[model samples]
Target: MPLSSEPKLISGNANRPLASAIARRMSMHRALNVELVDARVERFNDGEIFVEMFENVRGQDMFIIQPTSNPANDNLMELLIMTDALRRSSAQRITAVIPYFGYARQDRRAKARTPISAKLVANMLTEAGVERVLTMDLHAAQIQGFFDIPVDNLYASPVFALDIKHHFRGNIDDVMVVSPDVGGVARARELAKRINAPLAIVDKRREKAGEVAEMTVIGDVSGKSCIIVDDICDTAGTLCKAAETLINAGAAEVHAYITHGVLSGPAVERIENSVMKSLVITDSIEAPEPVANARNIRIVPTAPLFAQAIMSIWQGNSVSSLFDHETLSTIYDGFYSAS
Candidate 1:
């Protein structure tokens, strides 16, 4: 499907490959008059950010592709500044397409003095001239309420389920989708339902703040191929530990499918040395060098899903089909084959 006019697509330094892939995907359609805006987003020696657009964006529907991932502060600043620049240039609409939203883990105040950073970021974007927001697998769904403007939060489960069905259809009878924590049960259940597999949850409890969490499986995983599904993989502490616990609990093999791989600190090393079969992550965040070279880590593209959603939003079409496994599976699989 194509729009009446070409939308302006611009990207910051956060994830150029994803942005370019999205542009490439949309341009494949003959009827889609698409244009990737020429822009430069850089920082000065004094640590000040600078944004300059080479093309005219007046009255154009602009979408900025920038994931606030690693170096979160810098990337987030770029998004804010770019939105401000687009608004100042008289663009018709500005949509912030953040594949991996930063500060999402701080959606609520767990402690007395803590700040709801997620809400603060939402307020910041709206104030900076972002009329719409499109992100994937938000840590907390309630974060959507923080924004006054329209926010389209996408799920990566469709892609993951499709991949699971395609690759493991032969042995899916023995597969079980596992949630890393009780909070993620709904997400896990959705994937399990899509694949017609059983669902399980991991009960994690920590004695102290700095102590490792004690994990216990809440369902039968004996002789089952367990796949842990979660939204983020920061530090990889809980994830590696959960994999070990599942293996000890008689799981046939342990694999992880996390949406955003904000693998920081010793995450790569811990995952490399863990007993898990493999760790799969989406290209929501720009992966670091170690993650790319890790023996057991794999990355799948989210570009096609994003491009599909962008086109739907711009065309005023229903995005509900994106959540259907039968419909999206075909679209998801076709993107890889054609890409």
Candidate 2:
């Protein structure tokens, strides 16, 4: 990697808390001194967005930490406009660090007369001057192909594995990793292999929209501590239902480790009223008040991981080098214990 001045960190309103956490993590890095860029994002009364950089970014590597979450359209537009500002200001390379990529579920045309919205978003990002994309646990793996630039799709498997280990501790041998549905089997299998636990799947049939038919456990989960693993948890209807099904199948305890916690609609209420012991999610999306007040919800910060990736990209090291389970375990040891 040729010298491009230094890494300049910036963010939009989408996820300032996560951006700040990442900045703090970068500051803690003994190798480099990183700080948030002094920038401004303003909106016109008519609902248009405007971004301005108060500080210099000429020939600098700009990393924008903005998760397209909640108000997806507004936050997404802010990112594209901010990237344009940095590009026009002569930034060497611009990377969009989108933790929760919205419209990911629309990667394909599920029905006729529909568009592949995920591909459209990818095209929009490339057109907006994004040289690279750093995101986590995309809804569909193939969405990476939609971009002309490089895309780093990080996984939460390492963090989840480390937490599962610490959670089970001495009772590790009696644990089972479960996928809430068939689609998540691979994710659950990866975590199961990490912790050397058996894999289980929850098979549920839906008779119609908004209704689930009878559910069954595919593998033996009875009398074992079961940990369900999934990438996203939105609404949490399926997740809460899966937890209850696990308990009904005679599992000793049920827990969930999900990457993106959209937690929209009545998710908080469902989780609070569900039979699961606890639900663990990464801070990929900013937590709202209702979720922040939930009793059984636990959050493990992804800032440390993102900080490490940013440092590696700046230093010309391999981004994939950070995926090792043992390495991530050591990186987040303190926060894991606290959470």
Candidate 3:
């Protein structure tokens, strides 16, 4: 692979808009020798999946843009089938560009006899003839090691940081980055460092899988505007509860910077009624209707970053620099500062 060489970009049914946005950023036309096969996914009488890829892809460098988000099983099957199709067609290489990898939360078996679904998915991909994977902000970083093939785990921090800088430019001094839980302290710390702001942590207890009970703030959030940072926001119970706690601690306002907006169940409604001033998310996953229409929710694009990475991989260049904070700052300064 070389930077000068271009790979054919193909997309599945999931998140076509984001895929089109990425293609546009790469200056690619829709029908310019690139084809997206219509995968007629259906269920049999026994409730099993059936997938079909209707395109020719011989000797091509194929990149399948399929985010295994909601309806995770269907999308996953589609991606697997597409990979098999490309392999059967004698494609040179196949990269699964999964912007938001679903089932990533199940990377570890927290309980006895529990299955590690993330690793299972990785094995499925490898078995389906996928040569590599390109994804962003996985729920667990360790999931990368699950795959035997090269996994380029991209970050959405650069995109989110830019948006944060633009939205709170003059008031940077009042900003405090807060991690919703102990597990996310590192992620919050990174964002805080990027903006040169103080970092805080919320010490809360999760009584059950989807239920969170707020306890106390681990850091000083009083009298300062707070922004909670995390990898994903599903149900938003933890985020909203943390916001309420921060507000009670005398914080001026509370906001959130979540990479993937899963927004399942009553998430959008919960955020609408919660103390969070706003919730910023990246377009890694196709946002649901309620989230898309919510007033407090904002989506930042990650197309440019993905395009750059794809270009680097195609050019056989190092993509490690793309993850560097300084490099990100320089690249996104204009975009964020102007907002």
TM-score winner = 2
lDDT of 2: 0.89
Candidate 3 — which pairs collide? 2-314, 2-315, 3-315
Sorted by TM-score, highest first, which candidate order results? 2, 1, 3
Any runs in candidate 2 off by more than 4 Å, and if so which?
Answer: 336-339
TM-score of each: 0.96, 0.97, 0.91
Tell me the lDDT of model 1 at 104.
Answer: 93
TM-score for predicted model 3 compared with the true structure: 0.91
> lDDT order of candidates, best first?
2, 1, 3
lDDT of 3: 0.83
Model 2 lDDT per residue over 139-203, tens place: 98999999999999999998888888777788999999999989988888888888888999999
Q: What residue runs in model 3 are displaced by over 4 Å at the alpha carbon?
A: 1-5, 28-55, 207-209, 329-334
TM-score-better candidate, 1 vs 3: 1
Q: Model 2, residue 33: displacement in angstroms?
A: 2.4
lDDT over C-alpha atoms for residue 222 of model 3: 79
Q: Provide C-alpha RMSD values for all models, in order.
A: 2.1, 1.7, 2.8
